[model samples]
Target: MHIPELYCPIPSSVVVKDPEAGEELIRWGADQGFFSLDSDAANLVRAIDIPLWTALAHPMLKSADDRSFLNRWWTWGAVFEMRFDTNAGQELDGFFEKFMDSTARTQIRILSNNPPLRDGEDFSEPMDRTLVSLLRETEQRFGNPWRSRISRSLLASAESGVWEARANYLSQTPDFDLYQGLRRHSYGQTYITDCAMMAMGIDAEAKFLRHPVIEHIQYLVALYGGFVNDLNSLDRDLYANNRCSSVIAYRHQYGVTLDEAIRAVVDMCNGYLRSVLAIEAAMPDYGKYSFDDQEADQIDSFFYILKMLMRGNIDWYEVSPRYNGGWKPGGPIDPAPWG
Candidate 1:
């Protein structure tokens, strides 16, 4: 396999994860049908090691034995399968779209302090009912805007999945601009970012989220995540004849070989990260918006967590058995160190 090195400035952390929490996640996911309780869960654990990856990628999850966070991570798999799994086909495409839309409305009403208009309308399936529990847990901690923000991110992702599915059916390849806008949600990084912000006590209001610097950082974080995923999962996507990948698109555009395409994608990830660095360099100590001492600390934590998320994501991809450890199949390239 050809595993091209990705360059980044943030160092990887060596934090250990809670095995008990990981096991509990497997059990819960089984009950939800995200995986079977036995071999399927074991294989998923081996391939994705999602618990470790979750702990690694989210700074707040590190050293925190919160099962709610772990459950939320497990629950997203169900959402991913429902929303983007190709085998789920147009059936889930429509079903999840309608379900998620209703879910959004429910979340809104809850935040607005309005009662549900009726019963059994919230969740049509047990698989999806977990989301309600997770939402309530989130509300108990971070109310209103954070919960609404979470709903928006999840809805944005569901909506993007519809577009992506249509593009796949039509054999259309998305340009960088179009993909950049949707990839943040379609790839589910925006939801992850939202949860991170909520956990860190950052304001989830649009004013701060849409602040130019913060927006750019969030976009780059998504881009970094998307590009790295494309780099590692190129093998799987290629096998599925999926052309919605930056590496594949670059290859087709330039008529380059797969190895060359992979290398170019690595450069793309580096560019995204360097842009994030530049945003940090230009921003004030409190970032795009300023506030009191406590708020300043929260904002600083946001930046710090952003850096950790970027670094930990790459680190997880590097070590995970998933997507063949993020390598393209060709056996032993230089494995040369990248910047």
Candidate 2:
């Protein structure tokens, strides 16, 4: 329950600099075609926000040496972003309704003839299919076959168990236990969606979790005890009737003063940083060398960015205030803080 004393090595640059590397990475990403968006589609997306595209693309290009994996990661990210944008207009009701409808059909097929299930029984099929369909529709609309193909490939890989191992590992980690507890108690229903969104953001079309990057992101979330990202958006979530893990967790489990909660949140972030440093130290030279120095730098920058944002300064563009407000504990505090 205490913060670990781990430390990640600091990298030179917070952002990528090599133009040739950038171009090659983009081209390779285009060729792999995992996302629903093509070069043209990616370009269109860039038009909406060039910085965001660069932030996403630069890391993939820097870390992944394998042309195939790099391509798949970019493609998957591109397509997923497109689908997310397309669905942005939808309210929670519409999103859930669509999700539920897709789940029902997929569940039926999974249970009816897929063996290991008796007739008329319920089963928890993976939610990747719903995500896949959404990405496919986005790709079809944009005519971005490269991105779509990568998405399909990623889905195939996930079905084969490439990501499950990672998921199982993270879910069982001690850090995740504290994180999940906070999520379940404070955040409410929004906790699951936030987790799913984070999952979607980093997952490669449901194929593989981009090891270090995904792990890094999750590490940060767990460090904040799974609420910082959702903190700013508390009002919106409440408006939309969304539940947040931190809100629930703080109220039911760790009922304490705002000062105490903030302290705990900061400690969690510190713990997360330590955990990453530990992982990096243990990572083999060429064994899981997909992530390079540039990627590590980005992780560091983003982590600090979140740290600063949680402390107070609001950057609506980079950090949506409605959705990025830091989490504060709720309910009556105990006379003494729980150790």
- Candidate 1 clash total? 1
Count clashing pairs, candidate 2.
Answer: 33
Residue range with the least summed lDDT across 10 consecutive positions in model 2: 330-339
* Candidate 2 per-residue C-alpha lDDT over 53-143 given as tens digits, one digit per residue, 9 for 90 to 100: 2333233224333323333333343333333221123343454346435543453343233443343354343233433443444345334
Model 1 vs truth, CA RMSD: 6.1
Q: How high is each candidate's TM-score?
A: 0.78, 0.37
Report the number of clashing residue pairs per model: 1, 33
Q: Which candidate should be chosen as best, given TM-score against the real structure?
A: 1
User: Which residue pairs in model 1 clash with each other?
Assistant: 1-331
Please give, for residues 96-123, the per-residue lDDT of candidate 1 as tens digits. 3574466544533543435643454565
Task: For each candidate in the order shown, give its overall lDDT on alpha carbons.
Answer: 0.63, 0.35
